[model samples]
Target: MSDTTGGLLTIAALIILLAAVHKPFGDYMAHVFTSAKHWRVEKRIYRVLGVNADSEQSARSYTVSVLGFSLISIVVLFLILVGQKALPFDRGLPGMPWDMSLNTAVSFVTNTNWQSYSGESTLGFAAQAGGLVIQNFLSAAVGIAVAIALVRGFVRSRSGELGNFWVDLVRGTIRILLPLSFVAAILLVSQGVIQNFGDHTVHALTGGTQVIPGGPVASQESIKELGTNGGGFFNGNSSHPFENGTPFSNLIELFLLLVIPVSLTRTLGTMVGSRKQGYAILGAMTFMFGAALAVVTWAEAGMHSQAAQLAGGSMEGKETQFGSWASSLFATATTGTSTGAINSAHDSLSPTGGGTVLVNMMLGEVAPGGVGAGIYGILVMAVVTVFIAGLMVGRTPEILGKKIGTKEMTYVALYTLSVPAIILVGIGLAIALHGTPGYMNNPGSHGFSEVVYAFTSAANNNGSAFAGITVTSHFFQISLAAAMLLGRFIPIALVLGLAGSLAKQGKVPVTAGTLPTHTPLFASLLVGVILLVTGLTFFPALALGPLAEALS
Candidate 1:
């Protein structure tokens, strides 16, 4: 099949699958969060953790619980990574260096799987499975829990309570993530993703020995994509044949990363007692995603350069099994969703194509962002939209009957500004440091793009790299770790704060002056606000890097 035809067909199939599953899966999630009866196992686990699931928490308490749990997770995972050489499944690999250990630990704990080391060479099965994989589940669960709490902010009236963080976290893992990951793992293994415990050596066609590494890849791959964690069991990530063996598996991984984020919109609508609101949010997300996919695909397929034309397409750094179109799709999906698993080397994308994905991350990945992150991210945008609309219309801003007052907007402003601040500042610092030039593999606009991409990915909790820069130095390591940590928890803390503020307000009855947020107009406004905010903040950086390269 022609690449264009194949790409179109694959996209069609993906949309159909997403549509087929959206309502049922989204509604099921709503039920999962709202259900009164807890599973026996959940109760036991809660007891062991000293959590009173039945008791609700105010926003402050919930935030503390989340921060405390994640801090503990980081420390524990750090020790596991740094001490992995002593473990039985070491695979003859030494423990990670102190700085890299801290970076990896913070990366996984924050749900940003930004790796500075190759997975196969740097980690053993014990670290990959016992440490990283466990965080994949919990960190994702934490994001979903926060999103649910934010939803509660909209649903409840005149109350400070947003559900218990412990309850949401446990239920999200046990009831939602676990079963889905189990099924996905089996499907991936059936599709030829490796599921073994050791490496094997083979004779190469060049009469050389090759060591093929193997691990419990299927198990890790499932949760990695499903949770939107995106750390690869092998450094090649989804591009590695053992992790994503075929065209079908590639599509599956893409679907796994995107499904939860897309479906959570429906959950938002259901929980708010207005499916139209969810549809509005979903509409905006879909529009952004589709537009982005088109731009990257067009850019890659155009074959603008002399070399690309000679090669018949922009084939450099893309997997042969998955041509430019599919690679473009993967790039768009990975960046747009914040999953960051690259099936193709993002650094080798055409300048335009590269710029689009960078813009995707700059848009905060809310074009259906990461698992729990997307829903809340867009909701914050929606609030900003209404606030703008209110100013325009000379009326009070409200959504789902809750007023977007000064306190709420304070949280929204900080939530919106924090990540961009981290991204830009991080890039500026990296560029100014004298030793940074040594890290550049490409020395001009492309090099600038690489630094921008790294910090953008890290600060947004997206975790994909542009692949040409070396970030192993202490400065890059610590700075990127700080970016990941702040990029994650700052917005989360603010979102929870917004939730608490919203929860305290009594629902304002709908009236003639009230703005209808569930309409197409509102979705368009939300999209505009997202674009305006991102463009204003990141356009200068883009112009300096990708835009300059593309134009030149």
Candidate 2:
């Protein structure tokens, strides 16, 4: 088959797989969360925390409580980073500089994971385990809670409230994420990914002390992918041997990043009482993800050919153990879900691969996007697309019995457009200022694309970087900080707004002429709509970057 045909088929197969697994996984989640069997676990946690597990608190009050706990965690994490040098199990190169510590804390908490410091030299074992790993769970829990709130909006009967945030947060973390992460972490450890309590090991080799990294790497590695928070315990991220030891482990990491996001669509389908609609969304996500994967893999492979002595380094910054295909696949997986871990430097990717990553992020990371964020983000676009399609067909738009009205569409459109607006404006400002003269590492067009990609990644909360760019300057700091803030919060606020509006609506009954969303037809349409919308918005910016690099 042609590459395009193969790509299409791969995507189709993935969708079929997701569709087939939806009911089973959805039932599993329901059983895990709502069943009486889990109540004792919940009670124990509440008892330790000294709070009422069954409090009749309002949703707003519960949200505040969740936020309060999160804030306390952040403070604790910050202190841990600041005091790493003096902490037990310290193998640290002093503690993190104050600015870097602040950035790291914010990065992980927001699930951005935009590291400004080298990981190996700076952090100790305690900081790695307590600070970063804990945030991995908390940040992912936040995403899951937000997603569940949105799901509740559709699932409720005449209720204007979309579940309590505190309850959802606790259940999502303690019940779903913790168990899966433990199993995955143990598997990683068995595969030779490291877990330890000691300082960095020093071995005498060639008369130089080689500092061997050690920590609870395997533990964090699991949630780093599973939670969709791709912050590396080491600076090398997934490329580090301690974090991802073998090819088998690498493949497992890739699938773990994908599984939850893929499975959540099933949860969505279950909550809405229609298996087919969930399948439709999964089909669309799989199509986009597979297409990007093929493009990236082919581009990386083409660049690897010795026959093409291209001057620019395509594989220079990549890890050898995981060659072109592995790097390409990981990059594809990372972008697909807003997880920003890199086994290969994105800047070193063939322009085509780089371009694909950019487009994936620009697509709202909703091809089974960021943790809970990805699903809700894609669903927003789905709502907009359905609304538009309904207008064209001259009918009122309804999804799983929920009416698509002005209020719903307004929130969806705002949420959809917010990141792009931030990205474009940030890029425009960076270029207009000409960047710092010394910070133009690649110079000319590639340099410009680096700045664009960084801002886009930060603003979109997708933390993978075009590594060639020097973003340490005051200008980049200010610009990217702005992007991160806007990127992280706007969609969340809009999702909450959408949930509120959705919760107030009464479910409409399906009619004979109601669209069957679960079929291949709607799935195809959803994929096309996502592409059309993202393509129109980002094609120009992308052409200037990777397209230019590839053609040149």
Candidate 3:
């Protein structure tokens, strides 16, 4: 088959697969959440923590308790990071630098998983297993809790409260993520991904000594993809042999990264009592994802062709074992879900491929994005799109029985625009400063894309980078760090507030006149909205980078 035909086929196959999975996974989540069996497990956990799980608590009280527990977790993890060298479980590596500790702790807590510190040289095994791994699970759990809270808003009658945040957090972590992680971690270990307390060893290679990196890699690897926490256990990330040892392991990791994001669509439909609604959203996400994958794959393949002719520009930053297609696919997938694990250095990818990754991140990562955050984030955009379209068509906008009113539209607009505002402004300031003699590297268009992509990744909680850019400077560090924190928290706070407001409103019953969000019409509109918003914001910047590369 021709490349074009193959691309079309693959796109169709993915949509069908997602649509098929929707009902089953949706039913599974609905059953798990409403089941008495799971309640027993929640009760046990609450009992262990000395809280009366069965007590009738207000929503405000529950939210406070959940936030309080998260704060405590953050403090404990911070202490572990700060004192890892002196801690008993330290495997002899030096303790984390103060700034690095703060960055890692904040990164993990925010689910951004941005790592400024080198994994092999700086962190000890204890910190990896105890602090980082624990946060991976907890951070993902936070996303799932937020998603469930949003679901409660759609399900509840007129009430100020959605659901108990504490209960949602506990149930999501214990009942869903923990159990899945256990299975996935074991599978990873079986595939030669490491899991142990053994010290790092030196292997005698043909010419020189090579340090063989080891740690609780399997545990972190499982949740890294599962929770959409993309921080890798090693500096090389999934490209590292220990983290992804085999082709089988590679496929499994990719699937895990996609599973929850895909599954949540089903959960959304289930909560709203319409499986088609979830399918529509999934269709839209899959279409954008498939387009990204095709462009990235073609760009990389074309680069390999160019490299063959030049007999130069070795694909040095990529994994030879995985080859170009796998590496390109991984790059696309990582950004697609806001999971930043890279099997190859994106910076070295042909300009077009790297540009695709940048644009993908800039799309607010709503293409079935970060864990629970992705689905809800995209849905907010979908709501906004419907609202706009409704205005043109002279109709009230309703999505899955929830009316898209002025208040909800305001929240969506703010949430969607918040990160783009930070990213654009940060990049603009960086270029203006760097264009001066002292800071210029390449001092041209490509350099600007690197800065823009970095801020976009950080601000959107997508951690992939164009590795060529030197981001270690204080200016880059401070700017990107601020972007990461605000981009991560602001949207989350807005979504939560929207959910609270929505919970207080009565659901508008679906009628014959209601616009079906599940159909191809709505899916197409959602895609158009995503492209229009992202394209309009970033077109000039994109023309500067990938477009230039392609033309040249």
Q: Which candidate is the best by lDDT?
A: 1
Q: In every candidate, how many clashes are there?
A: 0, 2, 0
Q: Write the per-residue lDDT of candidate 1 for residues 1-552, one digit (tens) a residue.
A: 787899999999999999999999999999999999999999999899988889999999999999999999999999999999998789999999999999999999999999999999999998999999999999999999999999999999999899999989999999999999999999999889999999999999999999988899999999999999999999899999999999999999988999999999999999999999999999999999999999999999888654587888898888889988889999999999878899999988999999999999999989999998999999999999999999998888998999888899999999999999999999999999888878988879999999999999999999999987999999999999999999999999999999999999999999999999999999999999999999999999999999898888
State each model's CA lDDT, in order: 0.93, 0.77, 0.78
Instruction: Report the error of model 2 at residue 288, Å.
Output: 0.5
Q: Mind sharing the TM-score for model 1?
A: 0.99
TM-score of each: 0.99, 0.91, 0.91
Model 3, 1-552: lDDT tens digits are 664554444445545655576567667776665554446667777778786544433345545554566567757877888888887657676666566666677778778887777788778888888798888888888887777777777777687775556566777778778888889899999889998776555657676676676677888999998888899888889999899987668777877788788888888888777778888888899899989998888877664434434755336577776766677778888999989998998877777788889889988887779988898788788888888888987898877678888888888889888988998899888878834224434446666667777888889887877756766566765677778778876776677777777777887877888877889999999999999999999898899876776576
Order the candidates by TM-score, highest first.
1, 3, 2
Q: How close is each model in CA RMSD to the real structure? A: 0.9, 3.5, 3.1
Error of 3 at 120 (Å): 0.5
- Scanning candidate 1 in windows of ten residues, the lowest lDDT window is 304-313
Q: List model 2 lDDT by residue over 1-552, tens digit each.
A: 564454444445544655576568666765544443436777787688777555433335445655576567657777888889877777745887666666677677778777766677778777888789888888888887778778777776566676656566778888778998999999999888998866554768667676676778888999999888888888788988888888778777877788778888888887777777777888889888879988888887664432224744356667767766678778998988989988888876766778888888888898889888888887787788778779888899987678999888888888878888999988888777843545766765677678778887887777888866777666665567667756876777778777777777888888986776677887787788888888888888888877787777
Candidate scoring better on lDDT of 2 and 3: 3
Residue pairs in steric clash, candidate 1? none
- Superposed on all Cα atoms, model 2 deviates from the true structure by an RMSD in Å of 3.5
